[model samples]
Target: MEISGSAFNSGLNAIQAGQRRVDQAATEIASNTLPQAPVETPPAQQVNPSPSGAANTQADLAESLVALNVGKTEVQAGAKVVETADEVLGTLIDTRA
Candidate 1:
């Protein structure tokens, strides 16, 4: 099945949104003082890309897809981080206010 542009766009937007959430989470976490503070790894750090093609377009496409999937996983992990941060922030703010 061919993917429509709109569908692709939707997916991209969702990914972007998730990334934003993750960033917000990390920021919130950074602002607080806690025991055993978690080490947050950025998405780019998790993915390593090597050129997969030797003057071959097919191999290039495969490499690109691998990179894309890796990116998606990073974004997902980020989203989880964001959610965790959001929850912590909410609790703190509620207690302080």
Candidate 2:
């Protein structure tokens, strides 16, 4: 029972952590998409921004996307842990009875 309780707690914690990661990645993706240029900036300047800045944004976006996928996987794993814990507890109970 104690072990199952611990596992359930661990699963819940993992699920929460994954949810946080998902939220952060989503926010980053939203903020990074199609950044707005200043109104006063010339059309030619807007067309050709600094190479380093553009590269950085692309890298950040890629990282965020990866984080999103990782978060999804974590959530799935956490759910499995919780399920297995529940099954173990059930088996123990049945055996004792």
lDDT of candidate 2 over 1-97, digit per residue (tens): 7789999999999999999999999999999996677458776668656578778999999999999999999999999999999999999999999
- The top-ranked prediction according to lDDT is 2
Tens digits of per-residue lDDT, candidate 1, 1-97, equal 1233344445556668656655655444443324454567687895654444234545544555555565567677655555655666677678889
Q: Candidate 2 clash total?
A: 0
What local lDDT does model 1 show for residue 26? 49
Query: Which consecutive 10 residues in model 1 have the weakest lDDT in total?
Result: 1-10
Instruction: List the candidate 1 regions with Cα displacement exceeding 4 Å.
Output: 1-55
Top candidate on TM-score is 2
Question: What ranges in model 2 sit over 4 Å off?
Answer: 39-49
